[model samples]
Target: MDRRFANGTVNAAQTGSGPPLVLMHSLLSDRASFDRIVPTLSESFRVVVPELPGFGQSEAVSGGLAAVADRMAGAVDDLADGEDVIVLGNGYGGFVALQMAIRHPNIATRLVLADCGAAFSEPGREAFRAMAAASAAKGLAAITDVAMRRLFAPEFQQAHPDLMRDRREAFLKTDPGVFRAACEALAGLDLRPQLGQVKVPVLVVVGEYDEATPPPMSHELAAGLPQARLKIIAGCAHVPQLQAPQAFLSAVGDFLGRR
Candidate 1:
């Protein structure tokens, strides 16, 4: 089930057998972030969960997010084999998927952007710059808690101690250089102008309690896209698929199930 594409620059796990559905993980997380929902989704689609460039077994890419997006577009194209595929991205992955769709207009037939936005507010940009600086100066350890807080609310973290531990371990495995580079790219990123280029339908979903990207960001993303609908998963933060898998699935079911 493990496969390499784009000349082994991309690594992914494949399952099921039907229309292709690619799952891209967040910058703070790895491919495992989609573990909760993959099994069910695979039943209806050939699920391809890829580790974004510079994450897990995938090789890193330079030239900022656009370069990263282009690299992923190659991988998706290889996986799609001529047929259009569906791309679902979470958090940072959502940003990458959005850029990929923009740069490669025909790469995906539809998009599921979860907990991401076309542009971050000034304060949000400052946050990424701060994280990059802090991590570069002292390493990822210095901002581990901050990263975890952004991913999950304090209450949720407290309620799921074991899952928190697993998530923390996963975050620690991220390459520090890759983390800093992504942070810098996100800090300077603004994809709103390119939203018009994406002709595919998009399902923009966010957690009602998400603070990292927030609901307004998703609202703006949905409004900017040519064809997009917004959905808010109640009582969850970023990474709602991990926090509340059933609700997350319910939010995207209709869109994903459509022919």
Candidate 2:
């Protein structure tokens, strides 16, 4: 069911019942990105899929990723009701979850960070900067293809034309300002220094073929975290949950099922 939290500052959909498991979507995608895995996951857990701040029905926040993270922390706290919850974030959402966990140490008991990293390589940072500039100058349309490429490999995109069309539409719907702001934030972001602050166990999963964040980034993220293990979803790119939901679920099931 659709619900609002943090006094309607956050909009989310909830399903099933058990320990709360919050799912955060990537910047290029919306809450629907988690649709494939939610039903299966909700069978054993209360699946809470939230549209990140500035996306969908959620209110926007300024002050870069830290501010965004703080806003989500509030919403997650409200959802937790004093009980620690588990958070699973994909791409941009992973960064938010990581920052939220850092800023609010007790917000989550565990984390599943997918297709994200603690810091971007110089080239990666440049890519964000360029995208932000191009999108701001031209509009999201100018970067729609680029964005889709980041999310899925060309071969995969060719194989699933309808999915690509839907994904492209989703990317185009993103608020240009929000997209640019997130890009700028990510361009300068470096979370490695604060990895020590996160005390919860983390399952870092990445697509073996992910070009956006890449497997190396996940490797670095897992290595830096206090307690983290890495999983590579074979033959998938970014958004493996969408591309290969079963493989994504299998990669995380054992860890997420732990008490």
Candidate 3:
């Protein structure tokens, strides 16, 4: 279920059979977030969701995002066979996915980005900076639902009453120092210019009403990649996999089925 590498421990769930598919969840989430989509993806391929370092039961590292991202890349490299891997990342994890692809070019094959927050116009840096400042000022323990309002629309936040609270608590549990360093990594990251170098088939997914990453960012990812496809989920906010599971599965299935 889990292993300790030179970098950090990666808690992974490996099931089904076929090509190995690596899953990276969004910020404030762990590997378990993929529980809903795993069944669908496992039908066609082996699904491996690695709980990134410093999140959940995985190892906690003091390294910034780049270091953690690098460690994540190594973890995948260790598990991957000679064949390229199909990596699926949602929201902020998309940045780590991009880092993986960029750092481990040979192992990263096809990519599936769901409500990706990176790989586009990035004000992500400033947001991360604010988070760092907030953590420094009030400590990570005090952060609340108010912290996540930036990610979801006010109406969506109201409709899904418990989601923000749960996520806020989840993030708050993280080590303040590590969380702040991660924010530093996020603040320094900007992948828009490097999108052209990603030489793999890509599927860019977005929720029409997603306030976090939005449609324009998805379009940027699709437009930049050499061989990329775009799919927009209607009437959905961020986390379409959770918001509209069946539709999310269909879109992913169609894309993977093509290859």
Candidate 4:
């Protein structure tokens, strides 16, 4: 069931019992990004998946990466009862996860970051600007293909037509203004310098063919952190939990085992 916490700043889906595990979603996606894997995760944890600010039922908050991290910390504080929890974030969620570790050091004891980078390359920044402008000008319907290209490998896109359609439908459902705002938020983000501040164990996973955050970015992120490792999921793209759940789960299982 969904629970309101942090004075309604977060609308979270909670299940199971054990050490808390918080899940955060990517841009253009909501809490449902983790839907397929939440049940499995919940078996071993108290899973708390929150709809990020400006997405799903969560209200949008002002400011950039640091501010968003603060809001996420609030959710963690309420859900974990001040106990540090494992935080798993994908894409945009990964950025927030890193920020939480940096800005709110006590919030997460371990972090699993999938398909996200510490910061965008110059070209990447331009791409985000272009995407935001496109969304602003023509709405999400006009950028479905653009989003699909970033979210999946070329082969996956060709083979999973039905899933691609569903993703497109989900994207269309999101408010364009929120999407644009998120893009802008990413455009101004650069967290590389502060990566060393995170004292928690971290696992950085990326799809082998992920076009958005790519493998090299994950390598850089893993190398920067004091306690981090990188895992690349073969035959997948941005959303490995959907495209290659078993591989993703195995990697996560191994990481959690060490912790």
- Model 1, range 1-259, lDDT digits (tens) per residue? 9999999999999999899999999988889988999999988999999989999899999999999999999999999988869999999999999999999998999999999999999999999999999998998989999999999999999999999999999999999999999999999999999899999999999999998999999999999999999999999999999999999999999999933
How far is 131's C-alpha from truth in model 3 (Å)?
Answer: 1.9
Which segments of candidate 3 are over 4 A away from where they belong? 1-8, 60-63, 117-124, 150-166
TM-score of each: 0.98, 0.98, 0.85, 0.96
For candidate 2, write residues 1-259 as lDDT tens digits: 9899988899999998889999999999999999899989999898999989999999999999999999999899898877769999999999999999999998999999999999999999999999999998999999888999999999999999999889998888899999999999999999999999999999999999999998999999999999999999999999999999999999999989932
- In order, what lDDT does every prediction score? 0.94, 0.94, 0.73, 0.86
TM-score of 3: 0.85
Q: Which ranges of candidate 2 are over 4 A from the true structure?
A: none
What is the per-residue lDDT of model 4 for residues 1-259, given as tens digits with 9 covering 90 to 100?
9998778978889998788999898885667768778888878888999988877788888787777889988888889986669999999999999998998888888999999988888888888899999888887878888898999877787998988888888888887877887788888888899999999999999999989888989999999999998999988888899887778898899776522
Give me the displacement of residue 169 in model 3, in angstroms.
3.6
For candidate 1, what is the total of clashing residue pairs?
0
Give the Cα-based TM-score of candidate 1 against the true structure: 0.98
lDDT for model 1 comes to 0.94
| Candidate 3 per-residue C-alpha lDDT over 1-259 given as tens digits, one digit per residue, 9 for 90 to 100 | 5554435577777887888888887775556557777887887887788877777667766656666778788777877756667888887677778767766677577888888745334465666677789779988655544346545667777787786666666667666776777677776766777777788888989889876676887887788777889999887766777667788888888667623
lDDT of 3: 0.73
